[model samples]
Target: MSFSSILGYFLGGYFALVISLFMLSSVVPVAGFAARTLSAYISIVICATYGVLASIFLRIVGREQIAQWTTARAFKYVMAITIGITFEVDDPKRHLDTVRPAVFIGNHQSELDVLMLGCIFPKYCSVTAKKALKYVPFLGWFMALSGTIFIDRKNSKDARQAMAGAAKEIQTRKQSVYIFPEGTRSYAKDPGLLPFKKGAFHLAVQAGVPIVPVVAANYSHVLYIKDYIFRSGKIPVKVLDPIPTTGLKPEDVDELTRSTRELMLKEIVALTQKVQNRPIAIPATSGDGVVHASGADATLS
Candidate 1:
């Protein structure tokens, strides 16, 4: 009879459907992929909604810089719980914590990278996105509120201007930024890297910060849109040693980007091989095991 009643019914129905799909994905072998995929989509919507709310509150309180960090943890928690995946980041050197006002680069995968970002993103850091994503409703709103740097990848002029602005932010705010040098998701079924664009490298050089190479093992085998394969498993990520940009000029960005990609490519392939060859858990465990805050790994939250 009332608007609230209708809205309540719709919300109830949507959640009921998501729960049913999750149940089917668990037991129905023939329908697992389809059910899981749909459930994953719903899970993202749920997390994004949570992110929008959380980030908004944080932004209103003038903590907009860590807004993405708040939302990323939600993504890692909600998606890992609902979708059954763990992002295990192995940063032995703890460069992720020590590095500040730096440029971090990682291999790009699919839309599922939210899980990875949640697992590995350090505090006071935000990611760069294509300018197009600045208008995708709730997710876009969350990104914009959380200080995501948007670049128009197709237009060199706009892209450079965005990077220049990013460099300035790094200097003034002492913020760290993440970029995908591949400039796009690989979506490949194996561990590999695409040719890197030099934007991130140039930004690091201009900002006079170190370039930290973070790598996530290829989980295309776990999440293959082409084959509709959505399995619950771990995505291994490692944060490599940061390469300094002191005294580095624009002309040197090319070699820096090239060498960093080569090193990350090697580590990515190695991590993927380890994840692939490892024996599947008997009872199947989901959620990150690599200690987040304490323990030998000491991966920062």
Candidate 2:
């Protein structure tokens, strides 16, 4: 690593320690949360200012480096550092080659999935998110600048159009798209897996690409979606083999989604068993095609 790279890593590590210390303190949880949020807001401003300036600098100082694949790799690490510190992540490794430009499907158990994955996969990819993320001051602006695709989930027609737009962007532009098939996070320990949302599979079919199933193990063990029982433990990110949809039809979207969900569930169960060092029963999926606490099987008809 160059001097600049070393500096970036040190800064990134310090930032993570400071941020985690500020937020996880019991003396002032509210203050800590507010501080973290404020820091995120500030970081967005700093990153925007510096990132744009860096791009411009690259344009001026060394056009070759800016255009070089090496610089892009550096930027990915920088972004990954920012994400790791911000989310208090531990031992993040990309188990798959994200260079091929494919759709990523993962189990959603917390709000940190996007931030965590965005940091890990720093390629020119897009995420299918709700319209709300597009309105946030800093996050919204940054995501837009990063070419994220926003979908209006409230209106079915708008959602379809958004999905179509995303598909076109992926197929034509070769941009990877990340989507949480669960459509939401689960709070239960044995939440298993949520029903796969058809949108992700549809995108894969429309784009004629494979879907990379990513299993974020033990995310809930750290900081759950609905609680503050923060545990200092390693969250493993396992990027499984990509499920090909080369010869799939739009009508096969449901099957594709279900198959991916089942595969991810199996992976998560395996990981949790190893990490927690005990055998635990995973909840069965619901009738709506999502994993539920009641263990009801949800079939997509």
Candidate 3:
């Protein structure tokens, strides 16, 4: 069958499933959570599937560097419609465009964090992921194919090597990398932060690049897995000003990470006071088609 035919079938099947769950949710409230969760996960599968193909096509064409960017652009719309959430990016300073060869760090929440990535992911960027994720089906396949930097958290030597590779990418290729310094998902109901891992800071300082913090308001109000509370809502995200690491040393990594986390915590607390169902404010994108302030700039990268 042709590509359009395949797409039609997929869309039809997905909507049929989502609609069925919505109807069920009206009677059984937990079904709402199920609908949202399934829709989100399935949407991820869709993006992964597309990423796999996009990566293949780009690799064949020798332009695979933008595979994540291509997939991330498609990811925003696909996941947005399925999950029934809107991402409002606030980047008044256009940091998302001008900055390159930087390390982006963000607060890790639940799975919905991917949606945040979709909203603001820019061109020519790759993500850093845990090594384990390289084992998942389509998602992992796409990440590995699309040039994601995977780190083995359990092995310090391996993790350092991964960071070393990332630092080289930043310096040599001028590539930007996104990382979650929280190291794991918070899954918290309130806007707060866990202590940050210093790898991201180390990478930035080592590479002589700036550190950009992407903060998403606490979204547990939209997706709380423990309580099974998943509903359609808007998430507000802010891309703060970049913190320069041009003259930093290894010893500076600790203070840099600490001070950066403090800054992001303040922003998350402020932005987390989001008002749901408010007017949707579309973030401005530059002529390069890069959205300002996407954290995960997200592979939820």
Candidate 4:
């Protein structure tokens, strides 16, 4: 790693620890849920500020390396230090080396999903997120700098145009796009997924790229509001084999979406069961190297 990259990693962890301690001390007089909430927000703000600064610095010195340092390295360090968030990524060697661009669809559980995905996603990948996130201070500023595609969901016409532009970028630049097909976070008490929106599937078909499904183990057990103030644990992420969209038409979107959802849902259920210490069937591998469940354990930082 370069000197700047090393400095970024150190600063990320330092900022996280400093902010966490300050918040804990400041909230000592306060009690209960309010204190925990305040601490969480404080940690978020500090980490976000660090991210924005790193993004700006990288953009100035090496524009192409911003996401590599900020998201893949620095942000991973911050999350590990602040929230005890770690990842076990699946075997990415086969998929990450593909020449063709792909659409990465993942389950959305909380805002933290973005951080986790950023750490594991392949290089040259950009994110598709709600347009409103553009207003979220430092984080939003960094996202805009990173060329993230933002969709205005309130306006169908605008959203379609944005999606089309994203698809064009994927094809022309051979860059992958990561999107949350769920459109919003799931707040349910149990392990479940929301019905996916069709935009990501549509994009894959339009771009004639594969759809890579990413499943993040349910984090409700760690950060659910009703249960605990704030807990720390591992977040296992599984990246499944890519489903090709070759020779596929727009009409096939529903089937594609359904099949992909089923694949991800099964994985999520199995992951949840494993976490809860319940008996669950291990995923089997197919002849094509696509397994129902397959991945190697990896810690982000």
Candidate 5:
């Protein structure tokens, strides 16, 4: 470890401890809605501070060391500790040890999804983020340094080109890429999934890589819905079997997309049921009762 990284770790730990103390103090007198609200604000500031410090440390250490320090060290300790989030990875041996590059698709719940991925994904993985996230201060700077693929989702042509480039990256660099196939967070009251986007499937097929589905259990119970305060709890992430794309053509993308979606939907429903300790019902209609951008018959090509 470099001198800068060691210093960064120490400073990050100190700041996290201070913030955690403050958050704990907020709930000492009375654990009410007001205390939760105050803790939520403190948590946001803590995350921002960590982001800035991590960015500066990355810059000091230079590009070659960013991935190593940020993923393996900084993110794992600082973010997970401050937020009080613990991950329960199902079948880590089978899913996490794959040597070949693959496409990792996960359901999005909140901004925490990014941090969770950073903490748990394989060493050589990068994420596909929206182009606008590039403007988000320290977090944006860190992501750019880490080689995140930013796509302009508003423009179809640009989005397609971005996916093409991402596919090439997977094929040439042999690095796994994380993508939220739902395109956005499913923040609805219900757990119904958003329609799956085809770009990720296209990339997996084009690169002839396996599609690994990951389901992040809902956080509405532990995370305050009104104010976004995160309480200490286990966030279960179930990694499903990898779907192979070998010998698949462009026309097979739709079938591949549909099958993957079904698998994820089933896993998500089962996971949520486990969390709730009962059978959770899935509404027949789509998420938010409206067709998502991908629509009913959207296909990859």
Candidate 6:
């Protein structure tokens, strides 16, 4: 509702138009799939270049100003992408001060979760992604530069190792890591977290970090992974209070995961109720942005 948000929305709309045009030109068969792929690659390179330049400018000019702008840009891009797909998304984060260097577990409902979450967090945060995304043109490069952690989902051992490495990064780098515990997007309401896989939680416990649970609704209805088109509707995202791990050990991973999963399910139920009854406001930001000097932070306490 502020002037800045409105301005950001407009700026993002322009960027979205450009990207969409490139997407179409590269896809339309006159050039062939290979050519389209190549075109997409070129377009991605340009976008990556822009991202790098912006990052540099922000770092050099004023770190705080850039952080603020990046925050707004994240919102703008998510809003633009939502608009591009004719859908809407809401973002909310709770216990943000205790959020840094913690594992972020979100309800997996659609493919758009990556973009939505990326926009919500600061740039240093990473998403533990599948290896397939590495093949994406601009996305892959951006991921590389942005320090995204990718795992080879096909190879169990490799995936486990990648998860371990990602956990290490979260601990050592003191960065936020996002993962979808369900392993895949769900099509049903209150799908109940698809059972928290041990990978994400194991990493959290290993890193001695808290788990910040997020509940997202109406994303699947807006855009399904099977297709890339956009749809418009209110997609509410809620970040719940984080589960602390002050005295936690790896042995408690299962209990932590289970409790967080149950709590997230409850949040989903509440979000569903809000959707059915009245408007819900997803907070633009939450948590205090703090990082401990020693990597072993029990900040959530």
List, residue by residue over 50-73, the lDDT tens digit for candidate 6: 666665555566442233225334
User: Which candidate number maximizes TM-score?
Assistant: 1
Worst 10 residues of 4 by lDDT: 292-301
Q: Lowest lDDT 10-mer window, candidate 2?
A: 292-301
Q: What are the TM-scores, per candidate, against the unseen true structure?
A: 0.82, 0.66, 0.81, 0.72, 0.72, 0.59
Q: List, residue by residue over 1-301, the lDDT tens digit for candidate 5.
A: 9999998997677556555655565655224333444444455565556655665666567642235335544544554565566667786666766646888888887666655665567666777666778889867887776667655444454334446666777778777877777777777544667777787887788788999888877767666456545566787888888889999986787678777777777787788788868778755645322222342123221
For every candidate structure, what is the RMSD over all alpha carbons to the true structure, in angstroms? 9.4, 8.6, 8.6, 9.9, 6.5, 12.0
Better of 4 and 6 by lDDT: 4
Alpha-carbon shift of residue 55 in model 4 (angstroms): 3.1
lDDT of all predictions: 0.74, 0.58, 0.75, 0.65, 0.66, 0.55
Q: Using TM-score as the measure, name the better of candidate 1 and candidate 3.
A: 1
Candidate 1 per-residue lDDT over residues 1-301, each given as its tens digit: 8999998998788668766766776577535676666656777777777777877888899888887777778778887877789898888888877789788888888888867888888888998776778899866887888888665444444224446666777899888998777767879777666666667777788789998888887797789888777888888888988899999986676678667876887788778778787522222112311111211111111
Q: Which one wins by TM-score: 3 or 6?
A: 3
State the displacement of the C-alpha of residue 223, model 3, in Å, after optimal TM-score superposition: 0.9
lDDT of 2 by residue, 1-301 (tens): 7999997997787577657756566675554544444444445555456654444555466432222222334433444444333233233345344446788767777655544554445345556555668889866654555556655444344223446656776777666767777767776566387666577776678778888887766555555535544433456667777788998986676667677777788888887787667787666766647332211112110
- Model 3: per-residue Cα lDDT over 149-208, one tens digit each: 665544444223446656776788777888887777989877777766667876787688
RMSD of 2: 8.6
- Pick the winner on lDDT between candidates 3 and 6: 3
Give the Å error, residue 18, model 4: 9.5
TM-score of 6: 0.59
After the best TM-score superposition of candidate 1, give how far the Cα of residue 278 lies from its true spot, in angstroms: 8.4
- Candidate no. 2 TM-score: 0.66
Which portions of model 2 show Cα errors greater than 4 Å? 1-95, 129-141, 150-162, 225-227, 288-301
Maximum-lDDT candidate: 3
